[model samples]
Structures are given as C-alpha cells and as structure tokens.
Target: MFLGTGGMTPGHQLAERDDRKTAWAWYRGRAVRDLANGYTMKRVYR
Candidate 1:
C-alpha cells in the first residue's frame, strides 16, 4: 500500500490505520528491522 516512513519528526502518523491492524503490524516490523538487524518474522499469530 506504499506506506510512508516515520520518525521523531511530524507529518507521518501511522496510528491512523486502526482499521487495518495487520498492515500496521507489518509496517511496524519493517520499520523496526530498518533500525536494527537480525529481525526474524514468523506468520502473524496474533
């Protein structure tokens, strides 16, 4: 869905995607991976 990026700055608030929690979770995981390493993703269980 071409999600945008986020940071301590403004103009990027992802929390608005409350209707698509799965998309938000995946996006969050990717963002976390971008900031760190060794991120292993399993099928979403929640």
Candidate 2:
C-alpha cells in the first residue's frame, strides 16, 4: 500500500508569474511509479 507522506504543495502563483513544479522521486530505465495525490513522478531511461 502507498503511504500518505505530507510534503510540499504543488502550486503556481499567478500574482508572482511563477510556473513551478516538483516531484517526489524519479527512476531510470524503468516504469515510473505512482505517488500520492498531487505528487508528480518522472522517469528517464538512458
């Protein structure tokens, strides 16, 4: 089962014209795993 680990919030500030993103973790040469809601996941195979 996945755990609910509280973390930073993923947000974009319109007033400050900020477009930012964050991820929990990443893996290479493999499928990306799903994280808790609002969490981003990425994988790169080199």
Best by lDDT: 1
Give a tens-digit lDDT track for model 1, residues 1-46. Answer: 3354645224334444454787879999998886665333233332
Tell me how candidate 1 scores on lDDT: 0.57
Candidate 2 residue runs with Cα over 4 Å from true position: 1-12, 18-46
Give model 1's TM-score versus the native structure. 0.38
The lowest-lDDT stretch of 10 consecutive residues in candidate 1 is 37-46
In Å, residue 34's CA in model 2 sits off its true spot by 52
Candidate 1: regions farther than 4 A off: 1-19, 37-46
Task: Kindly report the root-mean-square deviation of model 1 from the true structure over all alpha carbons.
Answer: 13.5
Look at candidate 2 and tell me the lDDT of residue 20.
22
Alpha carbon lDDT at 9, candidate 2: 28
